[model samples]
Each structure stands twice: as C-alpha cells, then as structure tokens.
Target: MIQLIASDMDGTLLDADKKLPPQFPALLEELYRRDITLAIASGRSRTALLSLFGDLAEELIFICDNGACVMQPHDAPIFHNLPDQTIRDVLDLCDTMPDTIPVLCGFHHIYFPENADQAVENEIRRFYLDYHKVPYSALYQTKEPILKIALCNMHGTAAYTAPMIQERFGSQYEIPVSGDYWMDLMCKGITKGAAVQDLQKQLGITPAETMTFGDYENDISMMECAEYSYAMANAPEHVQKYAKHIAPANTENGVVRTICEVLGIHMDSLRKSV
Candidate 1:
C-alpha cells in the first residue's frame, strides 16, 4: 500500500506550459480521501509552488529548492544552507561566468544581480514569485539563510554552465542540473532523496510504501528512495534507467494518470465525482 507520493513539478507533474492538468484537483481530493500524502518535490521555491497551487498548496508537503528546504503543511520549514563563506565564493565565481545569472534563494525571496536584463528576469519570475534585484553582497547579509544558489543559463545549463560549475564546485557542494536552463548548488548531502527519507520516517512509511515520479537527473536521488519510482516517458533514457516504472508524458497528465492506475482509482469514477 502506497502511503506517500512525491512528484517533481516541472517536467513530471506540470506540462510543458507549466500548468497542472484539469483533472489534478479532483485527483488530489481523491488521494486525500484515501489518506495518501502527495508531496511536491521541486527546485522551485516555496512561494512559487504555493502560487501555482493556490489554496490547494497548503494541503501538500513541499521539498523546495531541490530539497534544500522541506516542509509539511502548517509546519515550520526545515532548511539546509551552505556555509556563508561558501555562498560568497559561489557568488564571486558566478560574477565571472558569462550568460549565467546566479540567484540566491532565501526563505522568503530570491535575489538576482541588480544588472540582470529584463529577459532573464521574466524567465526567472515564472518560477520565483517574490524576488528582488540587489547587489550580490546583499545576499550574504539576509536575515534568512540562503538555501541554495541557482545558476540560470537561458541557452541551456547542461551543455554550457553546468559543466563549468561541476568542474569548479562539484566535489565541495551538491550541484545538480535541475533543468535545461537551471543548475542548483547546495550544501553537501541535501537532496530530494534525503527529504523523502525524512518524510518516510516521520510518517512511519517505508520505501515500499512510497511512490515517486520525476523527469530529470536531480530527481535521481528520490527515484532511488522509492520502491515504485517512475520516470516520465519524456525523460531522457539515462534518467529512466533509475526508475522502476515509466509514466506517460507530463503533457498527457502522467502523474495523475499513473497514480490512478497504480492505486486502482478509476478515472471514470474520478471524473464523475468531479
């Protein structure tokens, strides 16, 4: 019996347009009725996730900032922050990299360099709801800890910025290519898998009782943490290799579809109930 379900937002749960399927609300209600917890695991910030889900957001668990922060509904969030000196070093390094803008993710707001262009700001606003353009030095002075440092490369992080970042900081930090255009840097050992394991222990659930879905490399850790892990059919072959199952593409409402199929919830009944 699956007691928990965690799914990545961007390429797994949300469609290419970043919208949730129409049936998602109904599906969520059904899951809640059955007492199954659905956790949104994403590199997105908490505020961003909440905006996307609206009032429904309060009902789900969140593993935000690629698991640098974790929270259950109505509970104080837990954070894993890089050392202050490390954050300064990362910011300084990002300054020298062309086409890559570093975003300092804090508990309340994400910070961008004051000189970032409008195009990049527009793209970033899609994922981060609350943001400020400030001098990089201001990031180190924030009252809240910096949860993660994300490098945004519109041209594509994997082929460009990611390798450079990996080569420079891979051994010292937990850096993951979170999306086609984004790579995240965090404290070592902070991963979606670790967050999932924490939740499992808290809820008295085991890997066999947990199910997860993801579509990228950053999701691999959590993929390994579930007995019923699924990779979206749209995922790369390398990512698929880590999962136990293959879900339909996100465009096809894969997360909800797979949940219904594996848990025996008829879509017909779900639609009728809606």
Candidate 2:
C-alpha cells in the first residue's frame, strides 16, 4: 500500500493564482487521519513554504528550495546543505555576470544584491514576500550558508535559463528550472528525489510504494525515481517527458480525483448526489 504522497506546489498543486484549492486542505486532513505522511516537494524557500502551509504545517513535511533543505513541524531541520567554498564560486559567477540577477535564498530569509533592478524587486515580491523575511541589496560576501541561488535574465532574453545555468554552474551544482523566469542551484546529489529516498527510509516504505505529482523540470528527478509518478495535464513538455502518467488538470480538481481513485472513494457516485 502507498504510505506517502508528495507533490510540487506552483504548477502542480497550487492553481495559477498561487493559491491552494480549498478541497485539498480537507483532503489532507483525511490523509492525516489515515496516518499517511504528506509532504510538499517544492522550489519555494522554507519561510515562504511555511506561510503557504500555515496552520497545516504540523501535518506536513517539507522538501524546500528544490530539496536543498528539509524540515518538519516543531523540529530542527532534518537535512541541510552548508555553503562553503562552492558558495564563493557561485557568487564569483554573479560578480562576473553583472547582468544576471542572483537571489540568494537562506533558510529563514532571502538576500539579493543592493543594486537589484525593478524587475528583480517585483519578481521577489511576487514569489518571496508572502513567506520570507527578505533582505534586499544585502549580500556582502559568500560567507553564509545558503539553500539555493536563483539566476534570472536581466533583459529577460534567455529562453532556456535552465541550460544556461548548467553551462555556468553545472560542474559544481545541480541547476534545475522550475519556470520561465527561475533556475535554482542546489548542492550536487541533493534533490527532491534524494529527499524522498531519505523520507522513505525513515517511514519504512519503499519508493515503489510511493506516488508523486509535479509539473516542472526541477520535478523531473522525483518523477523519474518514483514508481508511480504523474504530471499535470497542463505540465510543460519537458516535465511530461519524465512522468509515467498524465492526470487531469489542476482547475478540474485533478489531484483530488486521483486521490479518490487510489483510495477507492467513489467520486462519481458522490458527485451525482451533489
């Protein structure tokens, strides 16, 4: 039997508005009742993640910043990567590429260079303000431990920022793309998939007994590793390439439908009554 279910946020779980569906909270409450472990596999920073999860934080575990940090409710973080010499290597790249805006994500806060442009500021607000204690124009040297570093095109010209990041930091970091405007660098050998392996071992479950859902390139590792993996119907082409199944779109309550099907809830019969 499947003992856990993990899903990505943005394009996978949350709708286009970046809001979780009302039904999902209810769904999770039921999952909790069954003693099933639920977790978010996301590219979001942990602070922003907590804000999004809010009161439900107790019921979930987090694989945050594309799996750079892992945490659970009322606990010290379970897994974290410390930035050492590599951090300086990444920062030096930022220094050389002045046009490429870099956002440094920490466990509890985010820091960007003081010279962040208007577009960068707006993007930060849109993505991080709700959850993070943001420190703008604040990165001094690469001395602090960072979860992930984001690189975005200043001119908004790099069509494939994912590959571009690989060309730049591929040797030292694993660069994964979550969307058109963002590419995240996490330490090598660490990813949502790796985190799942860790979580599974702790829970006494095997990967074959797990299922996952995601809709971004960053999610591909988990999707490829899980025995049963799904991509949203609205997922990007690159995302779909890795998933074993294609589920309904998010707007249509696709996740709920899949859960009901897997758990043997008769959604069709109930829907007719409603």
Top model number, lDDT? 1
Writing each residue's lDDT as its tens digit, candidate 1 over 105-174 gives 9888888988888888888987897898987677667667789998998989998898888888999888
For residue 42, model 1's alpha carbon misses the true position, in angstroms, by: 0.7
Model 1 off-target regions past 4 Å?
A: none
Q: For model 2, where is the 10-residue window of minimal lDDT?
A: 129-138
In candidate 2, what are the lDDT values of residues 1-274, reduced to their tens digit? Answer: 7788889888778877888866666677677777878889888888788888788887799999888889877878954654655666666666766567677777767777767677777777767742232333246453456888877664542453545567877887787776767778888887998898888888897878888988878888888767779999988877788998987887766777887788776665444433
Global Cα RMSD, each model: 1.5, 3.2
Candidate 2 to truth, TM: 0.87
* lDDT of each candidate versus the true structure: 0.90, 0.76
TM-score per candidate, in order?
Answer: 0.95, 0.87
The runs of at least 3 residues in candidate 2 whose Cα sits more than 4 Å from the true structure, single-residue gaps closed, are 130-138, 142-144, 154-164, 266-274
C-alpha positional error of residue 57 in candidate 1 after TM-score superposition, expressed in Å: 2.1
